[model samples]
Target: MKELIISSINDNLNNAVALLDAIDSKTYSDDSIGPYYSSIGSHIRHTLDFFDCIISGIDTNDIDLTARKRDEILSTNKEAAKSHIHTLQGTLLSYIDANTDYLIHVTDNMGQGKVTVNYTLESILAHANSHAIHHYATIGYILNQLGIDLKIPGFGYNPTTPVNKREGI
Candidate 1:
């Protein structure tokens, strides 16, 4: 189960990079599909930061402070954002894989003892996958609307698609 979870995360992380590579960064900004709701870069970065920061006991305040598309620092720093996302993705997944035992230890931060139990590594894996896919699919739709072919390595219209099942359409 641990191995499966780790593999799934790595695949999703790679898919993120593929989609990032396919985007025309200049055109994906305040007026883009997700915009204030969730920019592609911000979505990827936030997912990466959430996993990395939460596990490392680092502050996630910075991500929360990031406002709308017009206020995004990553909009002009596409390369840096991609690099940050890649680095965080690798670190968090590796950390989780190495510490699979933590899956059973509930780190409940929810208020009033209303905390939910810790996610199994598999559940956490699914969370991360869903996070990235949700945002990436939005990006795909936006690009398509702009008549831009993403040409992604492993992504399809369907969100749950595995990399192996996709052939760069």
Candidate 2:
């Protein structure tokens, strides 16, 4: 289970890496296209921030989803975003042998107010993976608006989602 989870997360992160490699800096930081006007780099940074939170609090067993870095450089620089993803991938690899079932406290605001809840390490990782995929889908939309084609297959789709139903396929 641990191996599978790590593999899935790594695969998703690799998609980000591939995108960073394919696009130019201008396209990465371009926010001119969209109703929300969010850049592809911003989505990548936001997705990485979720994993950063996990890495930050995992040692203490207290994860705070709101404690994001939100670094402007990461939001606009493809190189910085790629480096951040690489660091996260290494950190996750180090935890491959750790106990996945260990309980941890996660704090996040789910509309009303901030709340802390118990979650297994595996569960939180799964959540983060899903969160990353969600952001990737948004990034895909931005890419489409920019006329950029993603070379990675299933880059912005959940594993369970049907290929025919995927947006911008």
Candidate 3:
């Protein structure tokens, strides 16, 4: 189970890297799009920050989701974002055989109030994986607006998405 989870995370991060590799800085940082006005780089950086929070809290067993370092460079420079992704991938790989039974204290404020909840490492990792996929879907939308192709299979779709739909059925 641990190996499977780790592999899934690594695969997702690789997909993110592929998307970044396929676009230039102008496409990545452009936020002139309608509705949300958010860039693909912002989404990717946000996704990476969640994982970073998890990894940083592993030792202390206290993860603060709201206290993320929203680095502007990460949202502007593709090379820097890729480097951060590789760092996260290495960190996750190192935890493959480690204990996940310990509780992780996750703190977040969902517009109502700040809430601190307890979760196992495995659970938070699962959440982070789903979160990254959600962001990737948004990034895909942005990519489409910018006229760039991800060129990576299943770059944004959830795993349970029907194959026909994923193939544009």
Candidate 4:
């Protein structure tokens, strides 16, 4: 189960990297719907931190999230921040694989009974991948609003293209 989860998420994360790579660095600063919407950089960071917080079961300890200022959340240096964003998803996969046998039942921030029934290792992994894909779409929307054409990294089909296979060059 863990293997399946890891493989699935790894694929999504890799595709996400491909999509991020398609985006020019300048678009990182492009604003979304509102000032509080957070630029692309913030979206990238939020993608990782939010998932890690949920999975790690230590969500409240995340200081960055407490920031009400949009600038603070979105101000991470472009190249370095993107690199970290790509790395985190892979690490999450590894973490889940290593701890597959153990069940993780974490409550959400609202203290709601958000039971994570990790009956199969794949369950958590699938959730994370789906979570990331939704965020990736946000990345696209931001790029679209910026009017920056999304470059498909290669001569053939790219990660940004809608397709079944998530990863491409």
lDDT leader: 2
lDDT of 2 by residue, 48-153 (tens): 8899999999999989998998888998889988998898998998888987677899999999999999998888989999998998888888888887776678
lDDT of each: 0.55, 0.88, 0.86, 0.54
Task: Judging by TM-score against the true structure, name the best candidate.
Answer: 3
All-Cα superposition RMSD per candidate:
5.7, 1.5, 1.6, 6.1
Model 2, residue 143: distance off in Å is: 1.0
Per-residue error for 20 in candidate 2, Å, reads: 0.4
Q: How high a TM-score does candidate 1 get?
A: 0.64
Give candidate 3's whole-model lDDT.
Answer: 0.86
Candidate 2 accuracy as TM-score: 0.94
Put down candidate 3 lDDT per residue, 13-105, tens digits, no spaces: 998887777778899899987789999889988998899888877798789998899998999999999999998888899988897776779
Inter-residue clash pairs, candidate 3: none
Clashing pairs in 1: none
Candidate 4 at 106: error in angstroms?
A: 1.6
Global Cα lDDT for candidate 2 = 0.88
- What TM-score would every model get versus the actual structure? 0.64, 0.94, 0.95, 0.62
| Residue 100 displacement in candidate 2 (angstroms) | 3.8
- Candidate 2 least-lDDT 10 residues: 160-169
